[model samples]
Target: MMRAELAQNFRQLELKKKLEPMLPVLDFIAWSLLKHNQDVVSQLWVLSKQQSWRTSKSIPNSLWNWICSAVDEVTLDPMTKHAWLLLSDD
Candidate 1:
């Protein structure tokens, strides 16, 4: 059991090392999409990137979902919204 746990831990650490470098790029992409009023969590977009990640075998499935979810949860403050559109109910 100890050996199994040690192996699992080692594997997870290696995965972390591989995936850590990707976090900044992922975050930037998500931020840019959101800034441009695009959806980061869109199925169409997520599916498009799957092949590359799968080919590299770096990013796991759950990580993609989590990144999308994290990006999706971010809301642009109204104060920071562009000046082009005036918000009114009329």
Candidate 2:
């Protein structure tokens, strides 16, 4: 059990290392989507409407819902929340 847990942790660490290099590109994509695509925000909202934390089916599902809920529960606006999602590695 300990070995399995260690392997899992290592795998997650490796994945993060691989993805870290893409941060800049990801930021650019988010920025472009927000700036050039007026429909992106609505699309995100529409997608969220169809999506729920309870019914999420992905591995580590409900990530976005968790984020949005946390944001909504706080003082941030929609734009800032969206920006937070784009900037956060999680």
User: Best TM-score goes to which candidate?
Assistant: 2
Tens digits of per-residue lDDT for model 1 on 1-90? 699999999999999999977865775576456654445445544576675454444555544555566554545566887999565543
lDDT tens digits by residue: candidate 2, 1-90: 799999999999999989866654654465455754545754674476478453324322233443354344335455557644544333
C-alpha lDDT (0 to 100) for residue 53 of candidate 2: 53
What is the TM-score of candidate 2? 0.39
Displacement of the residue 61 alpha carbon in candidate 1, Å: 26
Model 1 has an lDDT value of 0.63
Candidate 2: residue pairs that collide: none
Instruction: Please give the lDDT score at residue 39 for candidate 1.
Output: 50
For all predicted structures, in order, the TM-scores are 0.37, 0.39
The true-versus-predicted C-alpha distance at residue 65 of model 1, in Å, is 27
Each candidate: RMSD: 13.1, 15.5
Candidate closest to the true structure, highest lDDT? 1
